[model samples]
Target: MLDNGNVVWDHSEPRRGANDGTSYLCHGHLARLREIVATTPKAVAWMREQLEPVKGDFEKTAPMKASSKLPISAAAVDAADETLGLLCSWAEYTAESIGQPAPDMSNTWKVLASADSTDGALRVQGMRSDGIATVDSVARWMLERIDVIATHEWVEDFTSELCDQRATNLARWPYEERPKPAKGIECPDCGHTTLVVFTPAFAPKYSTEPLLRNGKPVEVTETVNVYDRVINPGGSVSRSSRLVKRTKRYADGSPVLATVQRLNYAPPLLVQCRSSTCRAVVRESDWARMILQAG
Candidate 1:
């Protein structure tokens, strides 16, 4: 028995010796005790029972295929199970406390921070998690829940699991900062509007910072690239590109970093597209107002 939160079986084959017993290798979360338990394993036994039901449910509903990626569903808590009760209660409590929509795919769980009415003393009064606990007094709340403590012996791993997922989220997008237009960042010389990217204040439940799922690590991605071509009246140097996958913050939100990435966006022109046959360029605001319509 490994004390860390991770659980794995020491049995190399499907069938072991008649006397092998169900003693599997297990690792607990960081907060879990470090000793390897050789006794009738609590976590391993619980996991075997828990997974059988979960796996059956997925097979019936989400049916896994060899090539298709299996989608993660919210952990199904048995209504009568006390541990699930604790996990659920905490989920609701944290949700309400988080007050923001949800974590970004980057696992960067955003909080609903209020601007200080007077001096910027932390005005966090919402029901967020203990990780972002502005008030240190209640930090042990995750462990304090009766619902969690009543669950399987592996419950202590929640903190480690939660933190690991959050770290994976950071790896997906480490550069998270409010978008601040440069000091002299006026509109470009073009009559066409320039686009400014931003991260929004709202979050959705689907936004999660995950550590790992189904034996795979999740990594968030953002990409951007451009040829710095200053458009003047002379022969214009233009480029054509395939659309690059981008982490599109809400079109109606605040902006973030402006970094170069590998992309195929059409090189934007600095001035109005004056081509007589080309009706591409329009008013800057109008250009910004256009939307990409799906065929």
Candidate 2:
């Protein structure tokens, strides 16, 4: 949503830089609505799997410690459901304004499935319980009918109302939350106190050590901490975290054991300047250097 208005392309005929056309306000709401509708069922399935009785569950004689985080997952599902409700309400309102028929919801349920792209335009297929097939062509309709509605005086007012609702709903989405800015820390690159530090989403943290299991060599993998000081900028040190496979060979030309490590799996901590015009970044490896330079 933070558009910096940087020109992305230049036209040769007119010799002018094209305006930035990447605003979430344009189609972000519809895209998010489709995403939530498609993924909510998966979240529901996962919740069911966690809550339902499964094989290997702890016995009544010695119950295992319950997870304290399970309720967070349930809360996330509720938030997603509420957000979807808001979006559907907005969609229904827009459909009404465009004179589109209201879909029947009496004895049937609607589910948004995979997108249909047979006719070159991308449209989400909504299956109803009563065998009625519907296509979510809001995006296509908007593109095709933009010119027709461009002159309508109510379009601006309607757009404002929709944007207000979208902003409220988007804020309620759990995954949309971002880390707060690191207070009073000047960005090394931009020299601005707008840096936000955050952990990498899915970084791996372990190396695989070879072990003998049932007379066969097996690899036992373990994970690492982001704070591990593996990167040494000074002296002779390996620079990249790419996967490395090493074999310790016997002096008589036989391999004794092997170790596999994906150093890249544990990505460096990062700090980014939130300033739109000065989006500077610094990696964990550069933190020491930046601090020394500032000192």
Candidate 3:
């Protein structure tokens, strides 16, 4: 995957050659390759770089899963085939002009090393030998032809072989994008999980107040103030819970979360329920951006 989420087939061992390597239209060895491209395939670069934080974070434990693959359209295949045909014609014509026989289009050969591997044997499509007298010429021809073929593939899909096209600016979505609240927030008072919502009116508030204990008004500053916005932010969140005894044996603790007060102000939260209940809110760290309906 060249950052465009397109799968890259390995050709390190020269699996594909001009004379006897797998180039389809022959023994059908290219069938698997075609099928791989046809089916939704994952990115190879993604698989190789599963280390998360992605900067090779040695301290981090969980590595990221593989990135998704982009679909390769049949139109792309058709375009590649068409371009290959034209290149073959060009090579053949040049060969004929030089008084050498044009390489037979039907002629195919297999790479000896690839034959024994469970991986299908590598094969090559032939080019007229006249214009391609030297290996360097063939390499240059291949590079140019593949570039053209890859261009068509990119146009058919956003995945491009060219770095310039492949890394399209993370195109901004013209429409408004809003994040969604997590579902099933656990109630602090009743322990019931309920869906949560938030609005600008529900944003957190602050004021100096007296909290009464035993009918005596004691001046206590409550720095941590947040509302449970939604269910546990999917994964672990460094929370604590109280142990519940079940039939005097099997038991689990009721979940409890620590409120992180802001270093500058209070409640070091990115977003909190501004609602009165302030039931429970998620810190911005746990929030995710998603396409949401307008309020």
Count of backbone collisions within predicted model 2: 5
Q: Write the per-residue lDDT of candidate 1 for residues 1-295, one digit (tens) a residue.
A: 4342334433442322111122121221211211111100221112213322244554468556789643422231121122222333444455455353321212112344458555544442322232111111112233223223323334335444444533443353233422322222223334233323222222212323335556554444456663455555687776544546564454675333333333211111111222222212123345343432111
lDDT of 1 at 175: 30
| RMSD to truth, every model | 26.8, 18.3, 29.2
- For 1-295, candidate 2 gives per-residue lDDT tens digits of 2245322222222211111333222232222222333333332223223332245545654554686332334443343344334434544565667787544333223444436645566333322322211112222233233323323444444445545644554554423324457765688667778877654333334656566678778543334323323646575454344444545456796666644564322322445566655545455567657657657
Model 1 residue 40 CA deviation (Å) reads: 32
Model 2 clash pairs are 205-223, 205-224, 206-222, 206-223, 241-264
Which of the numbered candidates is closest to the native, going by highest lDDT?
Answer: 2
lDDT of 3 by residue, 3-92 (tens): 323333443322232113212111122222221221111111112223222245557746535894434443333333333344355445
Indicate the residue-level lDDT of 143 in model 3.
28
Comparison by lDDT, 1 against 2, better one:
2
TM-score of each: 0.18, 0.28, 0.17
The candidates, ranked best first by TM-score, are 2, 1, 3
lDDT against the true structure, per candidate, is 0.30, 0.41, 0.31
State residue 230's C-alpha deviation in candidate 1, in Å: 96
Residue 205 lDDT, candidate 2, scale 0-100: 46
